[model samples]
Target: MSQKPRRQKHPKPPKNWQPPPDDKGTILVRRELDEYGLNIYEFRVLAHVARRESKAEGCYASQAKMAEVCGISQRTVLQALKTLCQAGILRKEKNEKGRTNIYRLNEGSKWKHPSELEKIRKAEESQEDELLNLI
Candidate 1:
């Protein structure tokens, strides 16, 4: 007797497909962000920043801290931070006490919002103009 072929297992749909509405409250696991080009590491950092318990004390963490928590190298954390910051998912700030950066979630940031990107571009242009005038 001939044996029948076995079927392959299908992938499961994501439980949480939508991005979190606000960055202040608990953030939804943004699986789509990954699908849209963000890697797992970058998504994790975004989630951590979004779920930060405190903002006054600088809820943002350093690359070293993120590396330790995520079990990745400091270089990887830095790379992820750059990607998230460029994507408008995170805001980076220098810690007053040290050189380490503190990352915060840009709660109002929307990937599809052209105004936001325009604002950033305008700010960069203004800075460039100021520098040129200074020369």
Candidate 2:
């Protein structure tokens, strides 16, 4: 019997191949966030903010710019920001000297997981239904 050769998991890059010039910087997102119930727009906005963060300035990108970079509407970006803030996954503060808001990622421990958020929503819905039945 002949044994077949094993395929490489990641093939090597081509010789003399250069990376793209307009490549944006990378963002490090924790694996735990996968269970945080974040929608696509929320995740995209978070990633864009993370990429633009700096030690001195933090992330102060405007909603319009974030929407442009994340390819979503400004209203969607605003809604995502609100949800992230409510979930304690992000902190948004007004810039004292500027109109744009400063955004920072909160500690992972502060984040409410998807399951917990879902439970809360279900409980609220049940309460509303019970109230309607009483009426």
Candidate 3:
């Protein structure tokens, strides 16, 4: 007796299928995020994560998936995620059962503008210079 082929849990899209137009399906990244001093990889990864967010599940894409979609290396994705999290622009929660992380974009208020970061950098540099002078 011949066995039947198994069915896919999720069917693949047709060869000719195309994504919806920008107006129909859009990812909204606030303009202020641009002033947050994010590098190119960080920006791209953040945008991709935002694109994957949903009202029900939030973003749970693996680093490999993020790298694949963002056209970046997994290590680069990891670094970008770390920077974003440190900057308070994104929050990451561990999924115990899934063994993956869920990402959420924090409110704009939590992010620091580039000018603030520059000020902090200058302050630290001046402190370093003072320490060196004493030494």
| Top candidate (TM-score) | 3
Off by over 4 Å in 3: 1-29, 115-135
Error of 2 at 30 (Å): 2.3
lDDT of 1: 0.63
- TM for candidate 2 is 0.65
lDDT, candidate 1, residue 129? 88
lDDT for 99 in candidate 3 is 80
Per-residue lDDT value at 92 in model 2? 86
Among all windows of 10 consecutive residues in model 3, the one with the lowest summed lDDT is 6-15
- Clash count of each predicted structure: 0, 0, 0
* Stretches of candidate 2 exceeding 4 Å from the true structure: 1-28, 116-135
Q: Relative to the true structure, how large is the alpha-carbon lDDT of every model?
A: 0.63, 0.75, 0.76
Q: Which lDDT tens digits does candidate 3 get at residues 6-108? A: 6523323457988778794465555677557777888889888888888667799999888776777887888778767767778999877698899998887
**Candidate 1 positional error at 54, Å:** 1.9
lDDT of 3: 0.76
Candidate 1 at 93: error in angstroms? 1.3
lDDT per residue as tens, model 2, 73-124: 7877887787777777788888898999998888788887666665654565
Worst 10 residues of 1 by lDDT: 109-118
